[model samples]
Target chain A: MNAYIDVSWPSLLIAASLLIANLVLSAVLRLGMGRRLLVAGTRMVVQLVLLGLVLEWVFDSANGPAVLVLGLLMGVVAGVTAVRRTSIRFPAAYLDSVVVIVTTAFLVTGVSVLGILRPTPLWDPQYVIPLLGMLLGNALTGISLGLDRFLTGVLRDRTRVEGFLALGATRWEAARDEVREALRVGLIPTVNSMLVMGIVSLPGMMTGQILAGAAPGDAVRYQIMIVFMIAATVSTATFGVTMLAYGRIFTSDHRLRSAGALGIELD
Target chain B: MAPPVDQAPILTAENIGCRLDNGWIWRELDVNLAAGDRAVLTGPSGTGKSLLLRTLCGLDCPDEGRVHHRGHPVLDQDRPRFRARVMYVQQQPVLIPGTVQENLELPLRFDINAGRITGDGTAAALLSRLGKSVEFLGQRASVLSGGEGQIVGLVRALLLEPEVLLLDEPTAHLDAEATECVEKVVLEWVDAGDRAVLWTSHDQAQVQRVRRGPSIDLGSAS
Candidate 1:
């Protein structure tokens, strides 16, 4: 395969042109979303441009400390976003989400880097950044969904939870069903996307690689590996977040802190 | 009446209060359930009858005062042990998903109540007393009617043989006959052992029929 030809700035005009159809449709229909769409589109462009600049710098330097700092930053943002995605609130929920998300994302990223895709020391940044970014992004969705379902389910089943507690159930036993359901709900997206990988739609990483002149077979291998890693990261992070959040919401005295005193804040 | 108040009162609460983010539900309420004592906890809606029951069984932390189970403050006792003895059965009990037998036997699965589990014979005997047939054990718990759920809840608590039952309107949804079956089971259970019960009921007749001790009335919200 020929070395990938770089698309210049003028070529981006063609990409930007795609937005005109949405703008025209929204305006012609007098839909109020046109302005919001314009604002969102502009912000997305600005964010991606900034990301491109940052990634270029990191790719050039490949400094160990700098790469780690960036990885931590991504994880933190992902963690915060996960918490923000949930409609429920409790005092320590944010801290729990961040802790679980960052720990799991870094754990999976490290394994994929040093263990599976053993790129040489210099290529570490290239492998670590994307790998961590993808894992963190997926972890954000999974953990957030898990957190949302878990707290919601507990609140919904407050009476049942208390009933179990009243019947000599430990906090873990009372909450076991809710946690299991939360994990299942959080993992569905990753599982479904994997289910339809090559047939329904080409995965983003593989498409990008193929576009950049990598062989189809190599791109498919990377995509397949990523699919496995994503599944792992999502399930582990989701399980961690829900269980940690469960511990936060239920008191040590076999009480659910969801209904009356020390109640969970529902936003 | 109330078996002579002879044995450290199976459960005791002095000036215990229930507070939420909004405000206090009840304040400075006191209750005592001695061996063989049967008392009805009464209050208008929102007066915290349910909250008081929860507070007594160690399911809720009182914003004020403390709960004592068998002479030990709730904090000092092992929680599962404390709760095992003073189980709080809800008005609409939440049955774990599965057969009614699963819900009834759930406490046995907990280490605190393990090894004491009897066979289905005892469970069926108790359920039959509550008007549930033997085959009722196999019915999916999720499909039990509100009244049926309350029966299962009581039977489940009985299977654990809790020393005291903090029943929060356990028969509120039952018809006359079902309610009688529940009262019979509860009264028989209390009469047979060291058990005590603090029950809340909307039915005035139930209060008169069940109480052997002076009733506790948390006066209507001011």
Candidate 2:
């Protein structure tokens, strides 16, 4: 603090080295990864720089409405990005659905922290922003994975599904296996992480809490609460996305015309 | 040649064409099968014979063509319905990963209404038709031989009671005796007044047996 030394020089040097290594290794591998690497590195630098500036404004804003607006915008952008990764078509309603689900889930979780557990100043960037980011991040991942697995199941097992239709299964019945597979895929990582927690190593949340001078017992309790909340939010978001996706698989003729829907094919 | 329009042909292919990458496989191909008609399709290697049969089954789409089952298009949203009415058997049949009974019931898992036909009687009848005992139901799909798997696939399709049946090299891997058995059962199925059969073969003699209908030979185009 006494010496206003620049720490960004080390980070810049590491970033430059990474770019050079990526170019050289991509050429050696002959896989054409160099372009993607360059673009990603450049984008990351520009994005982070811009975000750092923007976040300064966010932190300085004393208005609660401004903070809430920023949070809502962040959740909507995150949800849209996650949906785009599935390469599936969605109705305009889907965006609204994602917005409502993600914002509500994340905010509820955030508010629980405000009133009951960690009594802090309202709209505190230190607590609310980081927690909102974490919850939204997990929810986004769960939604994408759930949508992908469900769509894949529908595409790859079209014959099995049609075979079900022949056997007199309704639309929902035909899609039951796909839904089950998607839900299992979404839930498995959370289940596995829960099983491995504390046995293999300390989780990141617990470590961060401890590092911030909280008691170990308190940190563990907060970590447990976060895990449970994340699991619940993920399940709810996954179910919502999938149910909406199913409606898109059918046509006006009441048949499963899923060939072009979501860019997914029934086998 | 076209069949009568009002008769509701079990399967029809109109102006079918197939091409992949830079190669042209077949063009403007047409065929029709009414109830109880038996047809054999023969061609040399890479003549698009399998592609044509696959197109009939709604598995492969032609570059420019239309397929109809009972006078209904079998493409896009209509495919699931057509697939229910017509079953396609591949050369090396795909067995859904499960026990034999589970594989048989896989189609039922999709359509709950089809679950009604999943009782003991249907399983027994299908097994007997293929000269298999009901005990084969509990066997694992992974443990079956090539012929056994094909038989199971056929029996599974038969349980659906499809109106039209399409086969690709049905006897390619079967022994002489097994081949004869499959032919007999399939011929019997085709003889039923409400059903039809279209099959592919490389053996000239096999194509000649049980002369019930016409044979479309892919000439020079190979």
lDDT by residue (tens digit), candidate 2, B1-222: 544556778787778887776767887777888777788888888787777776676555567978877676754555565666776776666677778888777666554225435576777776776678888888899999988888877877777788877787887877888788888988887786588888888887888884466567776544
lDDT of 1 by residue, A1-267 (tens): 848889999998888778878789889999978899899989998988998999999889888888888888888889988988888756577788788888888888778887788888834788888888889889999988988899888876677677777777788887888999999999989988988889898999998999999999999999988888899999999998898888778877777875434345444
lDDT of 2 at B87: 69
Residue-level lDDT of model 1, residues B69-158, one tens digit each, is 666676633887788888888888877789988877878767788877678499888877777799998999878899898888888788
lDDT by residue for model 2 (A1-267), tens = 123335575688876997798699888999798888889988988987887776788788746676677677778877886677774444543574466456556666666676556744567665666667767777777777888788767766666664454433456777887988778887777778889999997989888777767788998988887788778877877777777777676443234544643444333
Stretch of 10 with least lDDT, candidate 1 chain B: B1-10
TM-score of each: 0.88, 0.69
> Pick by lDDT: which candidate is best?
1
lDDT comparing candidate 2 with the true structure: 0.71
Model 1 local distance difference test score = 0.83
- Candidate 1's displacement at residue B218, Å, is 1.0
TM-score of chain B of 2: 0.89
lDDT of 2 at B92: 64
